[model samples]
Target: MEVKKNPNIAVSRNSSLYFAIGLNVMLLITWLSLEYKTFDKPDVLLENLTLIEEFEEDIPITDLNMPPPPPPPPVLSAPETITIVEDAKEIEETVIESSETSQDEKIEERIVEVSDVDVEDIDEEVSVPFSVVEEVPVFPGCDGNSNDELKACFSKKINDHIIKNFRYPQAALELGIYGKVFVLFTIDKDGNVANIKSRGPDKMLEKEAERIIGLLPQMKPGYQRGRPVSVPYSIPINFQIQN
Candidate 1:
């Protein structure tokens, strides 16, 4: 008896769950049937249309009158008469005689005798030796009463100039270069120094010596035989580097 009472209670507990499952299955079947159904579409009709418009208005027409171009000008006529005259004469031609000497004539070659002329007296330029110059070049600020004294004074002034303007090149000093450079320069007739030449054991020393000599001021030109002449002067410069 107790087991029979329990059968209804077990069936009642599962009845609500089975009803929810059946309701969900029915809703899914209805959605699938609606999705798979096909329906016919309505036909669309189209017709072509044309519109006509008429406009009436009066338009005025005008005529154009043009004149023709002018005719060409008349041509000119030339005279048809011509006259002729004839004259006969002899033409005279003048004859010219040439003064050129013929090859048969003896050609005389004259010898030009040039006397013993001093080179200094001529217009030609020649460098005069310092020793033979009648008047030595006068240096600035050097006082002398005679040519000999002036030459000595010039020598002294040259030494003083070298001492005042001597400068050893930095590169030469760094290399410890030591030597004596002989610089030869010319004093032109214009009293300006020109044609500077230098010789030494090292090129740097020679160049430095030439630079110092070029800085010499303009002086009186030397004279040879009472005429101003170029004087060639040479001097020696020594370079010594101190440790």
Candidate 2:
């Protein structure tokens, strides 16, 4: 005989459905517990506000003792008799001379000679750029037959001068500052250097560069249109720190 009992008496038959229902109930309880919140009610005491009544006091008006306005000024008396006098003095008529000249008036012709007039010679200081000047400024001890040779010699001399006079600022060296400073100077018509300026990474370097350029000896002024003029020149000086 087969071992077949009643289906209602099978424990495992309804076990899966009971387990699913229990799981759903447990999930609903857990969701409710997580979403539920309770807030604490603060205790507040109510007090009655009492208003105090203010009384207004009356002020007595005092009259100021001002003197009455001064009496009107006395009227001036006029004479009853009027006298008529005749003035017999004659006034000379003023004559105004006309500034305009007529056609018949002869204008004096004066001859002006160029030699008789004073001619003042004014030396105007003119500035010219180095690159476009007809004759570049000549450095001392730099003699060349051609302009190109002169320029080369000038540049060489400038480099030599920078090397000779260049002294790195002790503060800059101590601060580990190194850069290239651009120096600009003007050679005036008197063949003297003026307006020496420099721009560098630091003021110390710029000051040192300016000092070096200022030490340059007098150079021959540049010429333009057969006239001496101030020439502006710019050069870069490198301040390097060697290891």
Looking at model 2, the pairs that clash are none
Off by over 4 Å in 2: 1-31, 43-122
Native-to-model Cα distance after best TM-score fit, residue 209 in candidate 2, in Å? 1.0
lDDT of each: 0.89, 0.91
Per-residue CA lDDT of candidate 1, range 105-200, in tens? 998899999899766645778688888888888999878888889988999999999999999998988888888999999999878999999999
Query: Which pairs clash in the backbone of model 1?
Result: none
Residue 136, candidate 1: Cα error in Å is 0.6
**Candidate 2, 1-243: lDDT as tens digits:** 888799888999999999999999999999999999999999898899898999999898999999999999999999799866558866678999999999999989999776766889999989988878889999999998877887899899999999988888888899999999999999999799999988989999999999988989998888999999999999999999999
Top candidate on TM-score is: 2
